[model samples]
Target: MQVWLDSLLALLSLPQYGLTTLFVVAFVSATLLPMGSEPALFGLLKLNPEMFWPAVLVATAGNTLGGALSWWMGYGAHKMADKYAHSSHHLRALAWLERMGPKACLLSWLPLVGDPLCAVAGWLRLSFWPCVLYMAIGKFGRYVVMTVALLYIWPDS
Candidate 1:
């Protein structure tokens, strides 16, 4: 198992499969998963400084797509969620979501609540394209800001 893990790590190292690995990491991280993709992005940038823009764009795209997937998942589970909709917390959240509409998706870049926010948008039946657009914009900004900040903090890396 150790040997296999080592081989997998070698295969996914930044030198040979940087962008693909970053995309996968970013996508999975944007889901309900507890992982973070910043380390992967920073590692790739540290290894290949020339790939800054490409890495950020790829990461943004992957994360946005993952959010869209979460939206669909929530859409499919609408009935299940409805069963618990009578709670006060659920009512308040649902009211806020309805009031904010697709604009709330701009916060999709936030930690902890971001991914689930996308799902809730779908559950509320918000406009799909608009939500995706907001998500993309927010995610793109996050990637650019985070990557630049990481680079600035570790310039020598």
Candidate 2:
């Protein structure tokens, strides 16, 4: 097990597979897990400057997919919590979500609240396709902005 784990880590660290690694990192980071994909993205771009746009796009795709997964999880959780659907807090939260609508997903790129926002969007049963579309746009913008800033600040040194 230790050997396999080490090998997997080594493979993920390889610059030759940087984009794939970036995708995985971005996906996992977008989940409820406590992780960040920015470092992985920055490292990959530093090693392979030619793949800037591709890397950003891949990261955006992966992260957006992860957000969708979170949305599904929230949907599932909501289903399981049907018993509490009538609670005051639950009703209040649901009302707030209804007010926000799918546009709330535009904030899905934010760090802390981002992932949970996706889940909440799902929990509220907001329109899935619109939420996903907003998530993709936000995630793509985030990747592009962060990658560009990192490249500018660090250069190719």
TM-score of each: 0.90, 0.82
Over the stretch 1-157, how does candidate 1's per-residue lDDT look in tens digits?
9999878866776555988999999999888899888888888887788988998998899999999988888887789887897899999989999999999999999999999999999888898999999999999999899888878875766
Mind giving the per-residue lDDT tens digits that candidate 2 earns over 12-44?
656668778888999999899989998888877
Best by lDDT: 1
Clashing pairs in 1: none
Off by over 4 Å in 2: 1-16, 80-93, 154-157
Note the Cα lDDT for every prediction shown: 0.89, 0.87
lDDT of 1: 0.89
Worst 10 residues of 2 by lDDT: 7-16
Please report the TM-score between candidate 1 and the true structure. 0.90
